[model samples]
Target: MNLALVFESGDYVLIGVFLVMVLMSVVTWSVVILRIIKLYQAKQGNTAAKQAVMESASLEEAAKKVQGMTAPIGTLTADAIAAYRNYRNTEAKTLAEALPLNEYLVSQIRSSMSRSMRQFDGGMTSLASIGATAPFIGLFGTVWGIYHALINISQSGQMSIAAVAGPIGEALVATAAGLFVAIPAVLAYNFLNRSNKTIKQDLDAFAHDLHVRLLNQKD
Candidate 1:
């Protein structure tokens, strides 16, 4: 409707707030979409990798089976295979030599697991920050709107219903705008965080299984 008239009277404070909300929404949705795609790819790779490991002759074969997989589990599998090849070539013959080599391989798996988890958590902090701050930002706009309305009334020496209600409505709209930005942000943050956690948990178990598989190798 008369967007120009609405923001014109408020010295463009509401317009500024609206723009900020729009930016936040854009950013939040971008992250949400990207993460969903990445996570889905990772989850699919995970299922394939699990089947590969179960069906293959050895852990090395499993890694080879799932070569060039997607992120998260793909990275972990590649690292495990690399570590397996490196240590196996060392030709550690005795129990003592093998024990140390196995420890080294476990360390490699942990490092790889940590890196994957970090990647899974990417963009989460910014999502949380946007959800937390958007409401207060809107409230700031609302507070300023009310203050501006009071100034307008004092200057004009008129406390008419039309004058008072207009500014208050403008300020209240700020609160509404804030909720608009915050709600979806919070919902997305929760959903993604939960899904990431589930993936992380699966990775943790897979790392353990990989550790056992690598150490059990009759190299």
Candidate 2:
């Protein structure tokens, strides 16, 4: 069928649906690529932060290594060091005398991890909404195409390959387009969500080690 025939009836709705699908596709890809990059950087930064802490002779040296660092692991380590120092410096107490210092450091580290998880999960809700609604939106276009074809058939009293194919083809394309937009969205959401869970586990583990290291920090 010629493409012109598909546009003969009320195709504005189809065009609108196509535009929406295109918009959804663009946003979905943008989120997927950006989040993947962020997760990778966080993972690398976490490794670098762990190495810096383990190799340093003192917590102060570790803090220097992570100074000005912006990654989640780096930030958490830096914050813990700061919290420990603030507690000792303010109370004029040595590390041995800072009884609640461990608890305070753990609380601060947990807060940082919570913030990191939230950051990692940014834009997930939008991805989910796109996945959940794209197919229905596409289906709406298909139903309209079929309805438009039926209206033409009823008006002209004809049903030939040429007469029926244009609308049916357009409807099928609409349905396929819907699935096309939705499939990637659903996959990305699931994959990224799983990656985030793994990242949170890593962060929690780092926090435990950091707390122990801070407790052993020297003056």
Candidate 3:
């Protein structure tokens, strides 16, 4: 009924299921912890970079201030500045270059934001996979364990409640283990997803302000 009994008495397939569940749980927690730390650092860096840019009175001053910043906002600001410069300096006209300065700048800044958000999406796919599949995997282990239990009982001809209950209970442990691995992954995925959206909103607002400043400031 306990884990020790399950491991000792269960066949190789059942044992393999347990080991796989353990590995999935380990991966889930590792990703959750690392992602949280990364997001925290990114938020702090973004806040500092936002303040630095806001305090600057001109585009040139903002550029210089954010030059050394490691935040996603710094990259966004750089992209905005580069887009502005490119639009101004391009004397040769092309179909793609026909867009207004604000539109061009907005496109470049949005691309930078996308790249930054993608970095935070590192382990999300795996978290989703584990959340979706862990329970089914545990059920497979349970079914396999019960099949072997039935086979053993058939050979021995012992149909007692004691014999039937013990193996079935042990088999159900795999399903329980699966749920244990899956629930936290699901919760963490939801939490991290919300956090990423909030960060994206902050970046979007910063990008908008930067665009307005770049348009208004005199060269």
lDDT of 3 by residue, 2-85 (tens): 799999999999999999999999999999999999999999999888888889887777889888666788878867777787
Q: State each model's CA lDDT, in order.
A: 0.81, 0.84, 0.90
User: Which candidate number maximizes TM-score?
Assistant: 3
Q: Per-residue lDDT of 68-114 in model 1, one digit per residue for the tens?
A: 77667677888888877776666655553366766877788888888
lDDT comparison, 1 vs 2, better candidate: 2
Superposed Cα RMSD, model 3 = 1.4
How far in Å is the alpha carbon of 197 misplaced in model 1? 1.0
Off by over 4 Å in 1: 1-5, 91-99
lDDT of 2 by residue, 1-219 (tens): 353444555478987887899999999999999999999988888888888878988777888999987778888888888888788778576654365876777777787778767888788998999999999998999899888878988799888888787667867677788899999999999999999989888888888877887788676
TM-score of each: 0.89, 0.89, 0.94
Look at candidate 2 and give me any clashing residue pairs.
none
